[model samples]
Target chain A: MSILVIAEHDNKELNPATLKTLTAAQAMGDDIHVLVAGEGCAAVADQVAKAAGVAKVLCADHAAYGHQLAENISALVVSLAKDYSHVVAPATTTGKNFMPRVAVLLDVAQVSDIISVESADTFRRPIYAGNAIATVKSDESIKVITVRATAFDAVAAEGGSASVDALDAVFESDKVRYVAEQVAASERPDLSSARVVISGGRGMQNGENFALLEKVADKLGAAIGASRAAVDAGFVPNDMQVGQTGKIVAPELYIAVGISGAIQHLAGMKDSKVIVAINKDEEAPIFQVADYGLVADLFDALPELENALS
Target chain B: MKILVAVKRVIDYNVKVRVKADQSDVDLSNVKMALNPFCEIAVEEAVRLKEKGTAEEVVVVSIGPKACQEQIRTALALGADRGIHIETDTMPDSLAVAKLLHKVVDEEQPQLVILGKQAIDSDNNQTGQMLSALTDMPQGTFASEVQVDGDKVNVTREVDGGLQTIELTLPAIVTTDLRLNEPRYASLPNIMKAKRKPLDVKTPESLGVELGSKVSVLKVEAPAERSAGVKVADIAELVDKLKNEAKVL
Candidate 1:
């Protein structure tokens, strides 16, 4: 049976998470279809058509889909769900918002944030904030799942010659209205997808000290992250938080400066290929997980590390 | 206007979860349990709405075994007007929970329904969205800020990049995020008074909702632990180890 991969994009561009989701879809089966629902997203549809392993691209263009409203998008996905054996979406904020609705309307269960595909019906996921991993099996005929993009390697984006087909389904919701958005713009790569990530914690003391991490991040061309304590202390915004409840990242190289490594914070980044912990406290829990531990005062180490990089 | 808030009792966040030797599930034999933190935030938001005169009454509900009534009473002590306990032996999946809540929403007919974005134990951020689907109501999830006007509510959501504000019509659902508000502790006087508040109990069979689960757990296991590594003497040695040994530089 064919699988449907819901493309995650923002009208003009496709999110890299969708590529990772496609990788999971490929593991389930070979026949895969990509659905791009947005306003004036013909370009995104064309991009999906070129993605490797995509058999076809279904484009739903309408003003209502521009924001990817759950009420409207779920209805549309439900409309097309019967023809496919499986429906998969990236576990982004957008996917988490709407995928459950799709599961319920289809009278099935959604396997949220599956890190591995043990089988078509069985999968592995984190529970209790990643403390334990559970393998779950679904008996429903149509399997609905949300993929943790960081766990899967993304497929090639430009290799296939799949056909792009337009879908004329309109679901305009009157119960909700879009107001405004405030997205943090940065020159650094996205925190989740970046190869190298540098993070701080409460030991950074205040918001101003985050600048020191930024200087190091600039030198390494890495994304900046923070612990929940740092965010709670108002040293940074909530979006920069890295923990069990926040965004999860599994980068190639992860550097923790002044972070004591609470269990929740460790759950988010412990999967990194290589980890470096720099803290003044010798008994910090982060040192237990670090491949290379450096006991140092970050105030003295940041400038020296940046200079050495040059 | 009346507001409905849902709470859950789960293993305390401070507790380190351990998988059973048989791989059935996480061991919960004698661990301390508390109100789910995000649900506490939802209860706080509802109580605050009533305190601000935007809501006339705040009703708190919980679904689980009889022990969950303790959480409901805690919500009442925190300033909820009444409490409802939907008793069951095992925890239901998110869909079944949503179905049960849909029946409660039908009975209460509140103008607003508030719940935590996700439970700390299951960590499946699904019930609120599922309930919204069943009730056909607009949903504002991961809400950091909620402001109820005359006929509409504006919710500021914590999205991936930053924040996004959306306005929903009356009779909507808002899920509380971490930054929603700091939940308050129950005062001594309120704790004594809450014992006298109205409390009701019902079952899923009485509500005409089936408790059958479509998903089954195969096994539960601990994640692979990372072995401790070497500690460098200085920054230069750390750089050399990264470039030469780890090759991650």
Candidate 2:
């Protein structure tokens, strides 16, 4: 049976995460269709039509799905679930919010944040904050999955000319209303998709100290992130937190500053291609994961690194 | 308004879980288990709502072995009014868990259902949303802040890019995020008080729910390890290697 991928996008622009999810879809089978559900998101549908390996794009444009909220989006996906054997999305917050409802309505189990697709029915996923990997098999007829973007290489966006189809569905979320979105206003690339990530932990001491990392990040065109402890200590906003409970990122270069990495913190960024840990403690767990570990006070190393990079 | 919170018993967040030699599952034979961290946040939120008069009553529930009552009691000690234990030895799939919770929701008729977004163990992150689907309630997942009015609940969610706020009509579901609140410890007096709180044990059968596993564990193994590497002498050496060798700079 064919697969349907729920495209992850905010009305204006398509998120790169959709490409990563499509990469996983390509591995599963060739008959892949992407469903772009949003209000006035024809642009997103157009982008999906260009994603490599997809057969078609399903654009479900309606006022009811203005924000891709769970209530209506789940209904739209459920309506389209009949034609496909598998429905998948990038394991972002948007996917996590709605996929379970689709699984439940379809009488199937949702295999979430799958790192690899062993077979059509079998999958590998990390459990307990990446300490152990569990290979799970679904017995349900229709498989619902959320793909961890970092596990798969993103497919080229300009390589295919898949046809776009408009799917109309009567869907509305009666019980939930959009309030307000407070996005962290930043010019830097998104942490999850960035090529470089310069992260600071609690030892950065305060919010002002993050400026040091920001300087280095600016030189490298990298995104700024924080450990859970740094976020908890109010050294940065919660959105910047990188850990098991926060965003999982696998940038090409991950520079961990003053972060004595807890296993929870390691779970998020350990998959980076090259890791550099800068901490005063030689015994920091962050060092263990780092390809290059620097043992010195962050106050001393921060400036020198910033100067060297600049 | 009444708030119903679901707590799950999982391997304590601090424990270093080890995979078994046979590759079946993690060795939980004698590992210390506790209430899931997110569930604790859920319980803490429910208790805070009760304390602030936003919720008139707080009820805590768990679906697991009888030992899960210990987690429920912990929730009660933190401040739930009562506990409901859906006692079972094996964990039913998320759908089954939602079905069982559906029965309790029908009986209790609470205005709000607060649950952990996912347990650290198994981490399917589906039960609350599934319950919302089966029960026909709007859900706010990964919620960091929840503010309740007469019939409206505004939840500030921790989304991918930043925070998104959504207002859910009453009788909605909210799954807790880590930053919602720091859960308070159960003091000795409160722990003793929780022992006297009403604790009702029920079964999935009693709720007329068919609990079955739709997913099977094929195998389990340790994740690929990243061994410790060499320590650089200074910032100069680090930059030299990053540019000349690894070339990520």
Candidate 3:
């Protein structure tokens, strides 16, 4: 039984989460192949071919897959489903959008966001905001899964000599038309791939105060993130949210400023290597998960921390 | 003019869940249950569409044990017109559920179908997309805002980067995101009116669909606990600790 892993890229660079998915795929019987589905993604496909465990790369270059639309990619993936025993992708927004359609097109079920693969047929996933973990066994002939990228360590991106193939299929969903996407621009590293992250919560009060975090994040070369409360308060964009329903990140260091960590927020970043929480409220739940807790006003702590770091 | 919304009953968000002694599943023997938060948002969106005169009827559906009717009724109390309950003991995976929903779609001929992105129990996040595939309809998942126009529906989705807007043909599928709408609490009078609303019950077999879980629960366990460390009195010590003790800096 072999595995076909889906690759995620921004036309120019690959999302590190795809490599983590590759790591998970390598563990599940290793005739591991990858799919780079996009317009002009030949370079991305070449990059995927160099991943240490990959055996082959399939680059599906078509206009319909330019935005990595689910409607287009689902058909392309489903078209190739019959040849493999397992299909895996990282549990990102793009993968989550398409894999379900592939499973239904193949008349199979999807096992989503598994943290661990107990066996080829069995997996473990978090439920109820990580309060409990469920070990599930699949009965389907062809297994469809989305791996939680935070749970698996990425394999080295080099040291392989796999061949790349072009898929000549024009998969399109005619009823839906993609218009435009507004991506937030920042000079700092991406939240998912960054080694250090600094997050703010509701106590930041408003968007203006986030500048404090910007300075500190700049000093540390860290990415900026926000709790759900901060996003809900209109202090940050939803993309900056770090919680159960938001981006799950596991950086080398996570600094939470004024964030009263909800269980959902904790679920996303609790896996970080070292967590530091700064909140005036001593009883804040964030302290429980923080390796270092500071009970002080963030207004005072932010500038002082910035000064101290500089 | 008809909108169909899918609701799911899950462990109450407030209750601290406990792992069963046998590790079969979470101990749900006598725990309080509520409508999944995301589903509540779905119901709210459907009701708002009706209230705005964009939809003539709002129908809520739940696929689960008989107790799931409570969730359907909650949707009714929140302004849905009627309810449909797909009764089953064994929960079906997203594909089977989508197949069953596809059958319902064929019979009901609704103009729109709305569902929560995923359920809290299994968290598959696949059913709405699967239903759209099985039914040959366009879909918009993780929608934060929805606007319906004649022959078309504009969906603004909360994508990973920021926002992505897409236009889908009418009679489409949309899965709700948390920021879509604020679900209202059922008032006393509305709750009373909901009890009298029509609620039809059927089974997967009755609908001519075979439903079963493709993924079986092998075990359940509590996650590893995060051990707490010491608190810092000031920023200087915190920076000192990060530079030397943790070595992350």
Candidate 4:
């Protein structure tokens, strides 16, 4: 049986998470193909072609596929469903948004936010804000899944050449249309792709205080993140939020600042390889899971920490 | 306009969940159950719309065990006019939940359906979108703001980048985010009044739908524990330790 992966990327560059999904797909026995569906997305197709273990690249280029609308993408995926036994995508906003639609269209169930592949049908995923892990097995003939990119290694892009093929599937545009898009321009790495992340919580107090985190993050070449409390307190944008309601991230190093480790917040970043908590509250719950704990006023320690990094 | 709100019963957010020793599932023995936080927001949003005289009726639906009727009653106390509980012992897959809700939507004939972005229990943010696709209804997910006009709804959604505003016609699905609104607690008087409110309980089998299992649980396990680090005495020592010992900097 063959596996099909949906490649995520901007038109100019492929997201590294695509390779992680490829690694998961490789575990299903390596007869894999990647689908790069977008308008004028040949560059993404080309990038997918160079990824290891990719047997072929199916490019669906059309004006209707520009926005990667769930409706159209679901239709395309359903059309491709018959050819593959398994389908995988990185559990990003885009993947999560569309994979369920495809699942419904194909009359199958989707395993969302899978952390590990137990078998062809069974998988491991977090439940109750990462407080519990559930291993699920699907009995359906076609397995649709969204893989957590952080749990798997990204496949190397060397020693393989993938043949590119143009999909002839017709687009079925629906009510959803492409709207104006806005992207945050940050010097730090993207939060989902970052191996290291330093997040500030309400402990930082104000937006300007986040500069302390920026300094430490810059020194480590890490992404800057925030707790929902910090975002709700207007200390940072919602995009920086790392929690159950926000983005679930798993970086190599996760440093939580001034943030009381709420269960919801821990549910998101607790999967990080190394956790460091710098909160003055000695009884803060974050310390329970933190590898490194410091009971200090973040305001006082932040400047000193920044200077030390310099 | 008729509005539909989907609710879920989950362990109270404040309660610390414990995994069973066998790694099969979480221990729910004496844990207090409450309506999901996001679902509370969704119900509150619907209630506000009805309070403004914009919505003709607010119908709350939940798909879970028979005990979920308590969550529906909770929603009734919060101001929903009626409740529909698709009783089942096991939690169905997201697609199955959406299908069951679609069946309810077809019967209720509501113009709008609002749901929590994801249930706190499964953390699978799929039901709302799946329902939208199943019913071919337009969806506005992770909505922070929702405004209903004559036949269209303007929704401000929370995206990774920032807030995104979208407009969709009637018969749409909207999922709530955390900052949508502060949910009000049910007063004692309201709780008494909710007892008199009508709550209809029906089995999925009675609805002529076979709740099929999609995914099966193999095991449950606690995440790996992190080793505790040393607590330094001062900033100078902390910095020196971080630089020379920890080597993170």
| Tens digit per residue, CA lDDT, model 3, B190-239 | 99999999999989989999866667888899999998889999999999
Residue lDDT tens for model 1, B1-249: 999999999999999999999999999999999999999999999999999999999999999999999899999999999999999999999989999999999999999999999999999999999999999989999999999988899999999989999999989999999999999999999999999999999999999999988899999999999987999988999999999999988
Candidate with best lDDT: 1
Give lDDT tens digits, candidate 3, residues A71-159.
Answer: 89999998888989999999988999999999989888888998988878888899888889998888888899999998899999999
DockQ-derived CAPRI band for the predicted complex in model 4: medium
Q: Report the poorest 10 consecutive residues by lDDT, candidate 2 chain A.
A: A165-174
Q: Which stretch of 10 consecutive residues in model 4 chain B shows the poorest summed lDDT?
A: B226-235
Q: Which stretches of candidate 1 lie over 4 Å from their true place?
A: none
**What is the C-alpha lDDT profile of model 2 across A221-308, one tens digit per residue?**
9999999999999878988999998889999999999999998899999999999999998878888889999999999998898899
Per-residue lDDT of B119 in model 1: 98
* TM-scores, chain B, all models: 0.99, 0.97, 0.98, 0.97
What lDDT is reached at residue A96 by model 3?
Answer: 94
lDDT of 1 by residue, A190-304 (tens): 9989999999999899999989999889989999999999999999999998889888999999999999999999999999999999999999999999999999999998888
Write the residue-wise lDDT of candidate 4 on B47-95 in tens digits: 9999999998999999898888999999999989888888899888788
Q: What is the lDDT of residue B202 in candidate 4?
A: 86
Candidate 2 stretches greater than 4 Å from native: none
The C-alpha local distance difference test score for the whole of candidate 1 amounts to: 0.94
Q: Give the clashing pairs for model 4.
A: A135-B218, A136-B216, A137-B216, B23-B220
Count: clashes, candidate 1: 0
- Each prediction's whole-model lDDT (CA): 0.94, 0.91, 0.91, 0.85
Q: Ten consecutive residues with minimal summed lDDT in candidate 1 chain A?
A: A301-310
Clashing pairs in 1: none
Q: Which is the leading candidate under DockQ?
A: 1
